[model samples]
Target: MADQPTPDTSPATGSVPEARIVIENCAVATVDAQDTEYARGHVVVAGARIESVGAGPAPAGLRGVTRRIDGSGHLVTPGLVNSHHHFYQWITRGLATDHNLFDWLVALYPTWARIDESMVRAAARGSLAMMARGGVTTAMDHHYVYPRGSGDLSGAVIGAAAELGVRFTLARGSMDLGTSDGGLPPDFAVETRDGALAATEATVDAHHDPAPDAMTQVAVAPCSPFSVSTGLLRDAAELARRKGVRLHTHGSETVEEEAFCHERFGMGPTDYLASTGWLGEDVWMAHCVHMNDADIAAFARTGTGVAHCPSSNARLAAGIARVPDMLAAGVPVGLGVDGTASNEAGELHTELRNALLVNRLGPHRESALTARQALRLGTHGGARVLGRAADTGSLEPGKLADLVLWRLDTLAHSTIEDPVAALVLGAPAPVTLSLVGGQPVVEDGRLLRVDERAVAAEARDAARLLARRAADA
Candidate 1:
């Protein structure tokens, strides 16, 4: 049932009636259990579920297909999944350009603290539009900053994702430790621990859908070890387990974070997280750049997953993550764009190339990562990290019709011999079409549901407003 689309009744979804779709005369890369690939093939979709995929033209006599798209000069693959992000940061890009992990957060915290519902909504709209147009069918946001009375920030983000027509997960993040308590964020930005927990629970109760075909889901997330208290971490783990939701947080992204863990709790980030009951199958942490062999072993042993953000890590001068070692050690790994503040190119396809290039700089250059492995990290690996692998990772019968048609015949990519290699190593390919739940989210290199120019203008205004408010305060 993986990749099954939600059977939505909402009036706002679109006007297109559900029907069959057949895409033929194109290549297929089904990142399935056996890594199936075909130089020329076809795919059939009935309503929201994939009906068939094979090496030749879609079996003849396919009936009732309202959409018959000739996918010549294109390669079809599973839609990319973004395992981690900060949608609110869409309006905060290009700031703190020369700072490392800690300084970058410190510099951006004030502006982020001034965000409200309106600001977050605009920012999220721009973010989701960019990703969806770039072939991301599923996205997740880790938003933690809650200034005193920012009305419904989570709702604002959720609404934007819905408006853009992409599967979404709102990782309800909180930060309780403030400057007064030896933490980094200003006191005014931090929420009361109890209040944060209560709000997270309520958000889950209201928005989370457990159905395999659900379009929206919720996760319990604390900001990070340095900015969130010990009690909060333990309690969050318990709450997430009780509610049967996944857990996410920042972990081991920098040496400074490790030093903080050692100074405050007499352990490294991974050990501290484990002591707080945060290491388990349902938990996926971002960065993991500074993990040692022991930490890798622990993550593999506990079935914990890691989200690899290569561009963000490189931008912030965070060390290269031990991705090859983790993979060899059996740790489930995925790719994340992190935040636009750290990685201005908030697209997932580029992450595939960056992940492949950055990991090769280390001692194990030969085995760091392969192009196919990189693609897996962006698609199936992300699904596994979000705890939804059984629902939306690969292209197989019975999975949701969430996939992309990359135009590899363009001038930039046509000369390359291998489609997969050209996609990962060559310049980024254009998305001819992207579908979410048997509907067109993007077509002909443009977003179908919203105006791109309008979205850009809204994002600019929101960023300006947030900056002014921060200055005024």
Candidate 2:
């Protein structure tokens, strides 16, 4: 996470009728344990929770008591869950495209040092808007960048998510080790260990809601093993445990990072993370591109979650993760869009598609992902990683009414016979209707929140200004 912005009143969040809503005659992919697919279905949503999921028309009990949406040609699925992201990096897209991870960060650190409240807000709004438009209902943004004097960057991001109406988890990421102390980040970008811990606790107390249906929650993230001190990692884990917040950080993202861990700690990345007390059910690591067999087992044994960012990994030339092996070993896995700078797109639909292609390209092609499985990785898999599976992953009765309705009538999906296959393998389409906890956030392919075009224009301008500042610096 990283920068600046002011509050913008949301232009819309379509009227959420208090009465029940019955979506009839739709092709529904439940993505449940049984992988249920309904040729024709109806879902009754009362308040923010789903009342029932059944085949065919609205239940007789719901006749005139509910608002009925004729879903004759649409496909409805549980909203995609984005496990990890750097929302602030939306302003840094397309720069250092030819550079690998380390070089890319080295080049952008100075420019990031200039981010303020306004820039942070614009980036968050723009990023969330795109994600929402692309069918992401729940998201976790691991924002760790805190340039000196950049006041309350996390708060600004939380504010943006609130306005956008996405289920958000603000991973309060930190870096306590600077270049002077053998870390990758510059000194100005690093905070004192004590400062980081204090902020973590404060942020959690102020913004981390533990409710089952929480709209916003907080997590502890110390950037990565290379950017934070060993002591800080341990302290962060302890702090998060005490505060009852989830833990997150970059881990085994590349061969270079693995080598750094070996040289610095005399152990592999997973071992070093375990030494810092970060191996547990409450923790979710961003990348495990270089995990060994033992590392995969450890994640399974400890119940640690993995957030796989296929597009960003490919863009940065980071090696492919052993996702097939990890899933086989029982390690929970989810999909992420990663930082916008690396991916340059907030399209979670594309991420789902890349995940399908990347897994097939690897040696694990024998264990390659199916379209429905990839869809699961983006939904239930992500929910498990973010520790929110119980409430929002599948379209079961009593679950949250968070879902996306896609029009399969488009040229991109017109000829598809299988709705699920059409969704996963076909060209990505803007979500026709999106709802978060039964509240409409996108209606008929238009954002029901802020002015989408104005937000995009402002974010574009901000990105150009930030790029020029970085160049000048």
Candidate 3:
């Protein structure tokens, strides 16, 4: 809480020491500087921190060892980070099929307007559980819809994340512009500008944690340019800086969005965002698929980050994000699974594959993105986007022990000689273990905190109930 945890090569800060857990005989992809890899290696976890990570066997005489694990058939990497998502849409999957970005938002806003705390709690629980099983140790959810009388929606989702045991960030989002003002969301679905700003500040104050190993944090997100007023966007950015939290929003995701920005504000998506003081080191925008050279340069110059959602963009017919170009131009880039409504899988691991394949379909083929690049995007790249790189992104001695053990020895993946290739290009590898701050959240490819079956059942019921509520309205 007082300082960024010291770099791993140094001693544990302060006086309190932790019980140690060791894992040996595994393939390690540190995802650190130099893209370090070990064909056979060991990782030692001490309480909530990593004690050491190295090749060919763990150091001997490790004291205070509580549990020793043999990671023979698994490949260990920094836990995947989901930089952008909508956990509330977990129950709203498979809707607005065959629609573009504009049409999709219009179709879904009514049902979203009907959401209450119970439904969102169930939905977020299910969504986080799914991502955890897929090896997501750190997750961020952007929940923007605030219907009248929706009691403690952010609290409900935050509670679910705590129960499931993943490091989480709730980007308490808002929409102050509606169809009446030429925005995509319905009039009743939007909140007043003052109300939105006030609520966002309250959420940050109640939930945001400045600790290096915090379980939950909050960001200020005002939906998107089309769905939020210019004043709201401008004020939201200022408020986020005032509170010392990060800012998130949708940008340049679709041709329609770009056209809307140009028509309304006489500028492109990136330009309009900058006009409102929304571009900077502390800001990360979702789905920068439509960015041009100038926009990319602006992002690079400002040290802004991008959350690339490959599958979601493809699902909604949003073009491929200029990920290769953005990375080349020095813009920080990370991966996002987006919302289950658009990306029903809602898993971070699959984004690695999707990002690789989708970018190959972009202007630069083959060299668009490699398996290692995809792995980095899901791991350390996302850490940078969420402002948690120093603590949780890579496998270093003093960093938080947030990582995943992918069972690459399974029949589906065993044939692939390279562990990283098997993980990225091959079939979905089962997660044998996933840890957040040295705590086990998933084991044997299932959620350890909550019953997976029960979570799915709750989400199913919530989805059906939500449909009824929307229909009645």
RMSD (CA, Å), candidate 1 to true, equals 4.9
lDDT against the true structure, each candidate: 0.91, 0.88, 0.92
Q: Which of 1 and 2 is the better model by lDDT? A: 1
- How do all the candidates rank in terms of lDDT, highest first? 3, 1, 2
- Clashing pairs for predicted structure model 1, backbone only: 2-391, 3-391, 3-392, 3-400, 4-400
Off by over 4 Å in 2: 1-18, 63-66
Per-residue CA lDDT of candidate 2, range 140-192, in tens? 89999898888889999999999989999999999988889987778998899
* Candidate 1, 1-473: lDDT as tens digits: 01223343435444565467888788899999898998999888888889998898887655565767788888899999999999999999999999998999889888888899999999899889989988999999999998998899999999999999999999999999988998888898999999999999999999999988789999999999999999999999999999999999999999999999999999999999999999999999999999999999999999999999999999999999999999999999999998999989999988999999999999889688999999999999999999878867889999988989898998999899788888888887898888888888998889999999999999999999998988998
Model 3, range 348-400, lDDT digits (tens) per residue?
87799999999999789999999999999999999999999999889999999
For every model shown, what is its TM-score relative to the native structure? 0.96, 0.95, 0.96
- Find the candidate with the highest lDDT and give its number: 3
Which run of 10 residues does model 3 get worst, by summed lDDT?
1-10
What TM-score does prediction 2 earn?
A: 0.95
